[model samples]
Target: MGSPCLKTVGAPSLEELRNSPAFPKSEDFMKGPIAVIECIEEIPCNPCETSCRKGAIVIGDPITNLPRIDFEKCIGCGICVAACPGLAIYIKDYTYSDEEARISFPYEYLPLPQKGDVVQLIGRTGEMVCSGTVIGMQNSRQNDRTTIVTVAYPKNFFDEVISMKRIKNKS
Candidate 1:
């Protein structure tokens, strides 16, 4: 698979990500689940910060500053996953198993996929990266209408699979 470091890839390039203080260390990505805040822009948003119970996310003055995550304090509860209006925050578990990993992201589309349903995993640039199985889903009034869906995918696509294709509901 090609790298996501391309600036035109629609996702933040690896080089750009490395320059950000909010970027999580590569070593930190493997220690169980953690919020992968992909808020590349400097927009004024901080719902993820208020949603984090551990204070792992911080958005200092200007309020427009990108949120930084302290991986050490992040419990990866995914509360921030649904809190982000931009739908950029995600929960990833690289240590799920020997060959499989899982990702949880905010899914707003209707007719949510059921557990065990296989779906195409999409990459950072909206490309089909691979397939994954729905493992869990959370929908509640507290989360508003954002449904946090978790899916299991191959461990190899840890960096590629950022989301899944939203299937159109059958008539």
Candidate 2:
């Protein structure tokens, strides 16, 4: 019998993210916080659509259709980020400050970083781009096992910093 294909798929590329209709524009970032849907593959899923209390996410009749975000209704609550099974949803706030931006993602790992902890910011391709600080974190029963972590980084790196890596053994 032939072995089953075991190739693993990596995260979406920068080009893909920039080209996706779901990705917000420069003006969209300035309007408070918003969701950046990294989900490109048309998989059978709709948790993100159902999780939005603001009714921001829309996935037509077909369950496999990609989730669409209505920026007008999105409140950047970050709830959809934790609800996505593929871990593809992210929340970004460019208005955090004149020099800094905020990025929130679903975290499901041990030793969660505390507020004020400096961490290495990672890009979509899993590469360390810069250093960021954990400014906020939330984990509630509603979020299930996924912890939402918010990191602050240089405003210029807002588009590059997608995830954060906690520094090990600070001591």
* Residue lDDT tens for model 2, 5-106: 112336666666667767887889989999999877788899999999999899878988878888999999888998998888999999999899999998
For each candidate in turn, the TM-score is: 0.91, 0.90
Q: Which lDDT values do the candidates have, in the order given?
A: 0.87, 0.85
Among these predicted structures, which one has the highest TM-score? 1
Worst lDDT window (10 residues) for model 2? 1-10
Candidate 1 local lDDT, 1-171, one digit each (tens): 566654556678756766776777779987899988777788888898898999999997889988899999999899888888889888999999899999999988888899999999997778899999999989978899889999999998888788999898799
Best by lDDT: 1
Indicate the residue-level lDDT of 19 in model 1: 76
Q: Which stretches of candidate 2 lie over 4 Å from their true place?
A: 1-9, 166-171
